[model samples]
Target: MRLLFSADGSSGDLIPMVLMAREFKQAGYDVCVCGSTEFEGMAVDFDVPYEAYPHSYSDIYLDNQKTGYIHNIRENIRHRERLFKGEFELLSKIAPDYDVLFNFLGEILVPSFAEAFNMANVKLFTFPVIPSERYGPPMGLPFVTENKWVNRLEWAAAVFSAKYLFSYNKTIDRMRGELGLAPSRNLLAENAQCDHMMIGLYEELVPPCPSWSSIDYSYIGPCIPSQPAELSDSLEQFLSQGSAPVYIGFGSMRHQNSDMLTRTLVEAARSAGVRTVLAQAGSTIGAEVEGSDDVYVLREYPIPHHKLFPRCLAAVHHGSWITTHLAARAGVPQLVLPQASDQYMWGEIIYKKELGPKWVDMNNLSQRKLRTALERLVAREAFTRHASEFAERVAGIDGAKNAVESFERVKSKLRR
Candidate 1:
């Protein structure tokens, strides 16, 4: 069957979706990914069919940040509204007819598109997105409790943000009307939409929650990709020369104060008395290290996590699900600097799970805080032991293959 995956998010969302698409393609199903042109290179590298947005989302978001959307909630909210509306128009124009719509949480409007086209659809989540009776709201909601009433109230705030801040209901209804379909209501009501919900995360890391929604769930672990040969000879040499640097990279989350953030990271690593490999993952952060030994800035290419993490004493990054899991799988302790979204949750989990020092917010991140965190990150043997244990557990995970089996099960079960 042909599948259209609308995953117009950053690397955390796109990379996993690309890996999943690759698996479906390998399984003899027609698959295509729709997303930012910034990551078109990754899709092309993986040999997956890709549709690109004219401008890179990173560029667009950075431009928005330049206008001070980073601090103001109102402007930030409206900026996102415009961004999604633009995406909706693009998808409606360019998408091909497909049997299934594999939608990402970021492109929430794609499900309405799927409904309009009469396509079988599954919502994809790299982490726990569904609000549950046992847990609470997902995606970094500050409070989660055992009380059903309390959780529901917190979930109302999330739903309210979707409605007012992002205009999710208005957008979905608008699209549905254009397609001559029924309007959507109660946008995130449990099982309000979606034929199935597939979670691509490590089963061991995900906390068990009782079902609050009837959508068929496929916890097919994380779609961890094979590392590309992106590391240069000079980069490899730099890694071998150090007493294992603290590898720092905030995957895709942006900061308007890029210069200050970059300075803070460099200074902190230096203060911790460790070598550093600062990965400028599409951010305007660092200059390439020519012969500097204390810090080697990676500006040209993304540091391959699988290859580089094992060589690092610790990793300091935005704790996106894929990054968190990969760092864990590589037996490296981390200093999670959460910038936004579900990252805060991952940072907290990493800390409680004893994988790293406490997670600090990027806005509040400083040389002193990071220095202390890195000192703990590099010196603690307990972290190494826990991280190694986690590594062993993840070493055998084949999330792509398992995700394909989940697709089969969902397809077969739904047909019956």
Candidate 2:
């Protein structure tokens, strides 16, 4: 059977989808990945057939970097027009050949397309919370600040943004029009005409939620595969020289004041008397820091955190879900420096679990805060013990294998 997988955004988003595609290919099933043109090289590297989706939401968001919310809303409004046209073109191109279309957290488009074309589609979520939960109160929408009145106003604006600016609502209406069905309140319900809906977070991360109808949502755990990048001889030697250094890496997102952050991290490591491997990912911070023999900085590599975490005493990270899971699985205590989004929530969980110290908001981060957190994490042995136990539990779950099996099961049922 041929499977088409659609995903977008950074390497984090693309990697999980690639993991699933690679497994399907190894299992002797035909697999094609549909995603941003930017990631076509990744698909080629895995020897999977590559198809570029016509447009991407991240492209729009990245292009408009103005500070204010209204500017963002205006940019999204423009993005909606471009996205709808692009989706129509892409769906028309890929619909004829594929048996099933799998989307990794990009449920908004592919599910609607599945309904329109009478093709099977599956939604894969990499993070703990799904998008449906994210947009509302249960997920705690980010723009909803402290005040109730402001939160309500923000919600109202968000609803308007969804209807008029976001592409999801527009795409749903277009799909409905094509299907000759009246517009529906529930997009997931409307799109349940597809074969299966698979959510890729583990049960440990996200418990089961109420299903809408015949739609299937399963928490298959974290679909983590070993993606190892070659480390330089110098780097390897450095790691060997230090007592297992704490790993610090924030994928993609750049800080405005990376120099300050880097200096702070170095001071913290020095203060805590611990060595560190700082991943200078997309940030301005260079590998070389002044007066820091205990710190090593490098670019982001595909090295499995599982492998690194065992050697490391602890981790300092930007709180991306995949990183969070990997750190937890490796049983490495975490110091989450959340920049935005659900990162704060994940940080809260880490602290609550006593696996690490409280989150340091990136905006308000300082050397003193960083040093204190690291000092506490290293001083307390309980944190390390809990992390080790949690890692063992996560190691037992074969999420990628399970996802492939689940797909086959759903495909068989669809045939009948």
Q: lDDT winner among the candidates?
A: 1
Best by TM-score: 1
TM-score for predicted model 1 compared with the true structure: 0.90
Error of 1 at 89 (Å): 2.8
Clashes of each: 0, 2
In angstroms, the error of model 1 at 387 is 0.4
Worst 10 residues of 2 by lDDT: 133-142
State the lDDT of candidate 2 residue by residue for 147-261, as single tens digits. Answer: 4455345445555556665666766676667755566564433434445666666566544444324556665677665666556776688788868898888866565556776
Error of 2 at 416 (Å): 9.2
lDDT of 1 by residue, 1-416 (tens): 78887777677778878888998999999999888778888899889999876557765564444212244344434455555666677767755467787876555566776766677778777744456564455544333345767766766777887777666568667767887777755666632357887777776667556653465677777777675655778888998786888888876656677787778888887888999888887666774334488888877665578878888888888778889888988888888877655666788788878999888777566689888988999888999999998989778777778878888877964421
